[model samples]
Target: MNFKYVSYLWDEAKAKSLGNNQVDLLIYRSNLLGADLRLTNYGGGNTSCKTTEKHPLTNEPTEVMWVKGSGGDLGTLKKSGLAALYMDRLLDLKKIYRGLQYEDEMVELFNHCIYDLNSKAPSIDTPLHAFLPFKHIDHLHPDAVIAIAASKDGKAINQELFEGKLGWVDWQRPGFDLGLKLADCLAQNPDIKGIILGQHGLFTWGDEAYSSYLNTLEVIEKASEYLASNEGKRRPVFGGVKIQALEKEQRLTQASKLAPILRGLCSSYQQMVGHFTDDERVLQFVNSNDLDKLAPLGTSCPDHFLRTKIRPLVLELAPDEDITDYKKIKEKLIPAFEEYRKGYTAYYEQCKHPNSPKIRDTNPVVILWKGVGMFTFAKDKQTARVASEFYINAINVMRGAEAISEYISLALQEAFNIEYWLLEEAKLQRMPKEKPLSRKVALITGSAGGIGKAIAKKFVQEGACVVLCDNDADRLKGAEEEFEKTYGKDSFSSNVVDVTDNQSIAKLYQTACLAFGGVDIIVNSAGISISRTIEETKESEWDLMYDILVKGQFLISQQGVEILRKQGLGGDIVNIVSKNALVSGPNNAGYGSAKAAQLHLSRLLAAELGKDKIRVNSVNPDAVIADSKIWAGAWAEGRAKAYGVTVEELPKFYASRTLLNEIILPEDIANGVFACVGGLLNKSTGNVINVDGGLAAAFVR
Candidate 1:
């Protein structure tokens, strides 16, 4: 509504493109609209432009409609993302179409009408945009407009609010039929500036791109102002006893325990990854007394049904229930998810048509658990985040609508039609193959920095949801933010955990379960080395060594196996041992002995857990100097002095000592870890992989 369109940005977009100027303009406008979350969130809205260009083969002028393509977010849309359709060819199909019973035929017609054979698939709403008369059209589900449109008296309120400026179309499932209805509505009201699809969204168009964009903003701003004036003073209050507010750490601790249980309950044929949020706004709704009554009303808009389904599954915890009690939490979670599944099946059966696509998995995308918090689940992290964002926005809009009047969403049949629409089904089918670790979760200790961080990055890149654990709270926070920015907020989470403590190690497993359901891969990379002779070493120093190097591995791995066994899914554990474990040096008695014991522990666990298909392996690296916290400052200076060189030359000296004469990096060690945990060495467990640029002494027979 603020209309922050800067002229220079538009100029820059135009200046870069010589051909396909229309697409360039469309991308520019789409980005502007998408930049404002109020206008659209994630992949919710679409834009299109009409243009005439010469066909590449025929050299004849052809009318083309370039519309936003599927799977591409408008905020980062590129010219290639716009599907170019031959307008004359598409409009001609309306004449030849015998009454089509199934929507699949209509989708086929649209696909055949594409002017560029290689263009990305057009959006499902392409028919609606094509049927409209204007040269440019913009459609968005703005929260403000939805607040007005979803009100109990939505149609009447829209009519009153816009006066005669906008036309109204009753809720129709988005397909050819709805597209035809939209065209009919516009034809009936020739002078209207826009069309408001009841409980759906807003559509505006003009001869120029800017006009359509501006009209959308103006209409949304007006609706926002109208709502503010009428209902701004009221605050929604639920009748529940406000539980004593817990501190942030306590809330997170509770969430960690509750998350895994709910995650396990939600898992189906395909694993479901969970992402939790105690976000202030989300908490306000989940904690509200009216949650059971209000949360079931349904999605704010129709397109949302594609991702979030009709409504969230609300799990009501007992007022006095202790969330930290894992056993009690499990008792509550199982029944709640099962009940939700049954209700979903009933809903699907009631509304499904004979030709409707197969029912989507019954697992709910959004879950509102009492006392704990809200969670969103998906096949991968990015999608989970998107679903979460939409639901949060829906909560705000529904709250606004309720303040004005009882909020109402579309009928179940309408939502079902959109959810099972063949176009969306086809879009899902057309998605590229998933990465190797697509739905798997990996937990890496010492991930706040060093080799652990590198392993975490690699796992995330390969499409695994990563849970990063480290003892350094400050570094953990920084790592969490960095990974979230690069891989998306849902892909990675960081927890401050001291591996030497059993409780802390248990918390790490809980965090992984809560953050990503349960773990399939565990990497024990947290370690320390003490440079002391056997005669000089204190008893405390030896205790510290064994606690971190031996006992820590046992505790974390033990907890990880428990969660993995619950999941009944095979898992991998990669321990970061050292070359010293295989070949000891003077003054390395404590560190070397501890690491050797850890190596044997890995072998024993592999032998014990092989029946469960849990693989345990170790990677022994000699002197990885770069990006290693263990080798920083005094340690590096001391090693350099021992090698008769400065710190800069120490790396070269160590590399020369190796058979391969190559300096080993953290990434090199991570690659070895990856081989063990990434199923590359699935059949070769209880083995030591030397990642020391081939140190002869450390070679395993």
Candidate 2:
């Protein structure tokens, strides 16, 4: 069959290479299936296989069910992530089942069924995967199949689309009960290869891993073809588009202005990072006539709404107004967000369980604007990006459902129940605590340089999203690639910026806004130095030093402040100053004076911006010899000449002069910067930290 929507990536040789290890083949099948979002979204769905393993205690072959554990993504799953439980013990859970009220209790009981004290917790759908008769099983939320599942006539459609080979089960919140019903459905239609769970997703199974994977592909492919065939008809989607999307540049430009405002308002309850997109499907949905009608219905898939929340808050401007008018958009977003909060609180009041987790973060995770795009805000960058993707999956479900029949949203009560489920609350409690800078976004100028790169890496390690800005495009690209491999593409973004130029600085902040909502930290580490005597300092040399060290920092800070105030989130600004700024040094007239200017500027800004809660601090380091760009050229030779020492002995000379006799390094400078903003110094600002191995003269008075 010619497959249009999904890619069949199964390699026969690769499957054979796994040999006879059942769990290994299951993992292979899982990775292949999960490589495409068409099969399942990130961290969505679960796969399982029944295997015979020698018991850790008894040393006897035992039937252990190995299923994808809670919070594990199929694409990245390993043996450690699979929960192993005794089959007989898991099935024995049925004997004591006291009905739906005790469903959550069943999850707790699953702990008692572990085969060999496996630490990975089983998902709530453990019964669904465990009780299934097949040795291998696949459960996925493929957009094509979910569209059919979320349709008004999903059950009848599922049977018709796959003929007698596929069976249907009504939507029941996934639990021990739903698991029992799924098994019953298959039992009733013994010849069917899979069952479509209404308003949920697809389930396919076979005796082996390869067969199960193929069965899943077969089901989703058929659904895609069916949806594709109908999409060719006129007015096939949401009653056709009422407004065409803006040009790509116009859309993102408007998004940049709109994103910070939305991020700020949504972050009132808690800080959030943001993501933006204008994919074709998103534009088709948001710009449609039926958007107003369809949007409030909410997403149907459990996994979709889990991250995106039940319904997205739709935002749009009047036809008469200009989308580029940032001021006007800001005015609209504030009250709309307030109203959204009120509605959300009311939703809680209406449907909340008596023991529900305290109404979590009333902020809407997903926000939609007509003719613009979708913006999602979450605690961190990856979560924000994943939430956007999930909502897009929701849009796909909506499209397929609406094209063939009326889309059926899950009942608000069910959405509420799932959102407030105790099991989910426990899961959240188990999550590791947020790192120091987790939700913060920091923009570090001269990030390709040693000290700047160290600061950027530290911030990312502490969980802040960083924007790496520098005039050197090649170095900036290399820095981003290095960060991408380690911290991932979301942890940092790179921009080629000449900090001395006002327009260049402006665009850099704009990129920060579009990339990660708004800036929470500003690091002005870009620098240059000339170690010439006052008499030898040329006019051009002095001007160049001041341009980069003084004017450059001012312009970058000016732009960053605008965004910080817009976000209404207090921010941090760390200026990389020099010990020369404090202690007078010979042959350093230009460099020393410029450093003094940057040092004083930080203090002045701290005093003036106190009301705005923007803290400004300086990290003064005398000799950051290791990995520092400032020490790589003429400055080293010139300083060495002034000290009457060889360039190679400069580090020792500086270290010997200090009371502690310790050599200063770039990472030490980075540590000082992080100390200023890493929650430890929230109440302290305008202070200068001397990272020159205890140099008395450079210490702030």
Candidate 3:
């Protein structure tokens, strides 16, 4: 039971809680093993159990296999996510089996074996689980185990460590043929608990769930111990660090600046969101003397290479260059990135089969910068983050393999075959279409209040990350809590920002840059309302309203344009003006005048920024009384008195006056802004969208 590298986390009480339900026990065991990154990368491993089930027709017992379904993570596998196949039906497929070249066709045959009518689709590894003669099995991509499997003398290393307690199979891409070879290996060596897949991963099994889980951990632990004693405490790895890493804060600052440039370059074909990491291991690899030699050799594990792409683009520098110099990095990165695309294009041309999927975006998924860390870009944040994670797993595998013997990677042709496999392409083709704001990020002032909060929610639902800004610290904190509760934590970042203050606005943009690389949409929604005749209105009141209503838009737009220009990605600026901007109303001098000015400013920005490919538009919302911070105070009484109605009668009064007899809510205003900035208006700028239930007097001419 001695453990060093990976922890043993099987709780007896927890396992016993599942009782006699073997399927529940299977899930419990799978989650425990998948808990550690050392055991498996996210969505990179499989687990299964074979149990007796009622035959659908006979009401008699039949053996069935429950394997983790295709495209699911082991740690989060649910009953619905498990692919259930009748074991007899799956085994019967060998009757019609052709040779290895016909293996992919086996996937089509797998559908016929489904034990449950609505079972999740089986993974290619379904055969790996089905053909093995064990009740419970775990197939994992543990870095320690893959390290040995990916070593120069991997088979001999298994013999050295397991001493023939485990079987060995040379690298064959997982499919029906590899599954058959696994069964043959187990039959030849009946005493072995599992098989080591050359340059791939490990498979271990037992008759019971916990036992199989323990056996999987046992094998990985021993491999980890062997590497630790020999390499963990020994000489420096990757030929020792060559370029020393910058101090923590400096590297992060550099990363903040570099991510947007990379994001911009990669977004030529499609928009991209980015994730950054500076893990100690990543730093060691990027700064190592052997990085240039080892990195381009590519990753060995399919799980690793598939997410990270075959290899990474490593940033180069002369010994005299300072890694912290952002100016120098900005100049060099584009050419280096271009060379990677050319290399990738040539790789595709060299290895593509007739039916191969057309070469994709060609941009590198994982980028390695010496003395910095790693940056990965993808269509969404989670994918980008996961890509970064998979590369770290690749780094670990290389480290472990190099520790005991020379590390080995997949052959380029073989890697190409797996990466561009038509089956894999079909999965990509099956993905849902991108949401309108899929890769966009927005920054909103007054986001803690009614219309602004609603707009932030709508943007997130449409797949945009948002930065929620408000000047009121308490309200912003409360709004942040609501946002986290409503949309999980990663949907947005929040900061206390005063739009009227230029210095405050500058720091807000920095927060946006640090949190999400940069912003794509800027919404000016902060406002205060007052209903006063010229005699009652103070000079200070007019200045305050303009500062918040008009100048807030101006300041936020000015700061946000800097980021948008830096990204070279055209963006959106939505000004939330008011119907009062168009309608002449009594006792509304200051509020009306400022909104009119705001509307004009939107048109002016649109005309000015069109050359920059930035679109500017305004949404005019009328009588937005419900849940409005402005309406909750004296503004409500003032407006109600102007209409000769009590504050209590205001909602009905406003509704009756609108042409459609409908009262506007915060969400309605949010929709108007969306209509202006969403792809529907991609070619239109300097436009006004009215969400006021048809206010004739407020209509834009």
Candidate 4:
């Protein structure tokens, strides 16, 4: 809302218009907006501008819009940082809204205007911009406006305050219909300067860039002023309901019921919104009368559905209720949620048109009526931030509108119609997947020696940041030093991790995500050996082997896959399996079973993650002597002694047993990991690649 910053950005964006194909401006705007986004946390909005110019070589005119892509906030939008969008096509598609079927047709229509083939789908609200009559548009759900929107009669209240100053639309399901509605509104009010989408957000425009940008501040200030001067009688009768008085027991009960479903839908929402209740102002607001009415305004924008789903939780508290029974309270709340889900299903079925996609889940985005405040869910930090902002603003806007008349929601069926509407779903399902990580971050576990170290080095050679993790801290440190000295680039990092511990694995992934933005490739090369027959293998040894191989792989893969889902980039995970997994190995029940479990886990993950563009596969290597720590250890050494051969001769003995008599090095296994990157084997996930030196007849079964 700062005029100076807006002016500065407008000038800079105008200045950066001379180049063909540059991401600098897009990145700059993303950071600028990102700051505002982080501060407001949930109501952070974005902007984009379209321009058409003649190509220098072809003499043909192409269009591009400077869009605010992922990864940056809007409070600090800079020129050269917005995503360059093809403009003419966007404009062309903007005019074609006829005869489109639901999901499939919608997805097919979205393909008409393509931006970066390397990034995820364009923002869900891109369609909003597609129909904007203006070249430059700024959208936001500032807290000042949202606080008013949260009221029970938000629509009526906002209408009275703005009173002919802004164009208002009841919250339409924000897609093609919203765009068409906006286009109609613009047509009616040739002089209609700005638009305020009820229960949704604010859209500002300009003939000259600054006019629209400045208008946003001007209109928001007007609404803020109206609320300031006419806030009505200060109802302090509920002042006795202090933060401590808002049952600590009831709060936990509500969180438990809502967290899992919300978490499953969008994993990061609980963490972000939970922090607000800790603040005194938010807690006081929740304790006040406004709490009950404002809890169900939904999100400030439709896209918020992606993060927080649709609604937040509402909890009803009685003055004398014993607040100490948290667990008992949660037990009772489950049935209420079940009832809500049932009601929701009926609503969806009744209201949805024949052209909508089937509902994906029964969970409500928001919780209500149980003495608990709202909770938003999201897949990542950014999504959660957006959800919280939208929730906060919608509440404020609802409150402001309540002074005039009753607030109206689109009929449940209509909402269901919009939510499950095929066109809307197709936008998400048909998005083209990209592989930027063919050159991004690579994480190699057990990278001190063998295939792990090779993969780690391979990533470094191919323009990627590498993290080397292993149980042997010293060797990992050594590899780190060698990487730093050899390349003299600070592109390699190391972590000493015991992957068997769930907590440790979680922390390791957190570290990886924080340090390198995100992890794109994960190679599990850490394993253990007992080398005893089933009866001879001690219980303790069997436990240790399973812990290192099966449990370690499970935890590591889980953590890695979660982070990859959030990064919005194509991700790859490679498991190091033994040929023994495919063919039974003698005296190796525990090890074989554990490895087989790992292979199966990889396959399952591949299926689950294919939608997320994450690939999971394993390399099955046989008789590789390059980094055979098992052979150097007690069991293999003892076996060598018993066979009357030195430890060095063990390599020859294993190689001669193979059909080709060839020795495979750790580097060979590393190459298999590298192949998974760059999208080279994109279509080949779930299958195990044989990286053995050719041993057929001797294969144990």
Per-prediction TM-score, please?
Answer: 0.86, 0.98, 0.94, 0.53
Per-residue lDDT of model 1, residues 67-121, tens digit only: 9887778888888888999999878878866654665477777888898777888
TM-score of 1: 0.86
| Clash totals in order | 0, 0, 0, 72
> Taking the tens digit of each residue's C-alpha lDDT, what string does model 2 give over 1-701?
45678888888999898899998998888888888899999999999999998888889988999999999999988888899899989989999999988888888899999975654788898999988889999999999998998988887887778887988888889999999998898888899999888899989999999889888998899899898888737454888788878888788777776677778888988899998888888998999988998999999999999999998998857423464555667787778888888988998899997789999898899998888888899998899999999999999998888877778999999999988888889999989999999999999999986999999999999989999988888888889889999989889877899988987876787788788988999999998888898889999999999999999999999988878877778899999998989989899888898999999999999998989899999999878878767688889999899999999999999889999999887888889999999998899989999888987777777
Candidate 1 global CA lDDT score = 0.79
lDDT of 3 at 280: 96
After superposition, the stretches of candidate 4 with alpha carbons farther than 4 Å from their true spots are 1-35, 38-135, 141-143, 146-165, 169-192, 217-293, 296-300, 313-337, 354-356, 365-411, 428-700
Task: Please state the error at residue 688 of candidate 1 in Å.
Answer: 3.6
Per-model lDDT = 0.79, 0.88, 0.87, 0.60
99 Cα displacement, candidate 2 (Å): 1.4
- Per TM-score, the best of the predicted structures is 2
Best by lDDT: 2
lDDT of 3 at 640: 88
RMSD of 4: 10.9
